[model samples]
Target: MPWTLPSRPSRRSLLAGAAGAAGAALLTGCSGGPGTADPDPAVSLERRMRASSVRDSERLLERYDATAAAHPALAERLAPLRAAVAAHTSALSSSGASDGSAAPSAPAAAPAPGAGPAVSGEPVPPKPEEALAALADAERSLAESRTVALAGAPGELARLLASVAACGAVHAYLLTPTPGAAS
Candidate 1:
């Protein structure tokens, strides 16, 4: 008989075994299955709110980044605003509210900073003035959303949201062009 090593279990079998183990764990509630409920509804609600705020902040940052990329002239002006949004996202994520179970859905798409209809994927290059205006509008909207979420947040989270809202408001104002200003 030819000398041959015993055939090892196929790769598919290994993957199946691993998946089966994971499914068993989930079914047994070892990883907080669907049957599990949060101990405190209020806390759960607060976490959801925080997660939503983080998602909004992240969307705002993406808008800013897209605008800056399309119109390099505005990059310098948008840098600080982007930094502020990034800080808000970092704070919210670090607060333990970004766990997958409670994380909010991401925005469907980030619109280009332009007057025409929003296009997904490839963004239309926008003029500097229009881009800035769009960025300001996005910031204002995010700030409003954050303000609404503040009511449900814990003390520390509330304070953080308040500061983030204030910063967003300031960024919106700063992004607006002054009358008679060069484009």
Candidate 2:
């Protein structure tokens, strides 16, 4: 047989190749286009809830600090509770981040005296007994809020919220004044 060089690909073959490439690009593009769109509603809501929880934790920590500072005797009791709030703030902040890394540590110093109320605009109690009652009330409120938040949170976040609720409940009990204690 006479030797023959292979002919270049035909126009039809080149057109078919280009068409296939275009179809593939279209299919992939349809999956996720370049436009910036909002995330799923559920995911957005969950993120907002996480941010709210972090803010609440920060306020609660500030309240604890103010109460402990005003009444030096209460400092020992409030220290652990404050630490727990800090940890909750840390976890909530980190878990909500896109990168899944821990947030920066909060400053060690507590807010200055008369900074603000723990929740709402109510003033911090002036007396020790009143302060403890206020703290307990705040803890109970936080626990309740956490319980509500858990229902909508994703699996890991739900678990974290539940644990935080349990801790808040315990803190509430510890803050409650004894029957015979001065009021």
**Number of the top lDDT candidate:** 2
Please give the lDDT score for candidate 2: 0.70
| Candidate 1 residue runs with Cα over 4 Å from true position | 1-39, 96-125, 180-183
lDDT (Cα, tens digit) per residue for candidate 2, span 1-183: 997644544445544543443344334334534563565875777678788888888788778877876777778878888898888888877755568676655835765555545433567788888998898899889887877666556555666677677677767767775454484
Best by TM-score: 2
TM-score of each: 0.61, 0.67
Ten-residue stretch with the least lDDT total in model 1 = 115-124
Instruction: For residues 1-183, write the lDDT of model 1, one tens digit per residue.
Output: 897653543445544543443343333333334575665884776678777777777767677667765666676877777777777787776645446454433333434444233332334245777767777777778777766665555555666666677677667767776555585
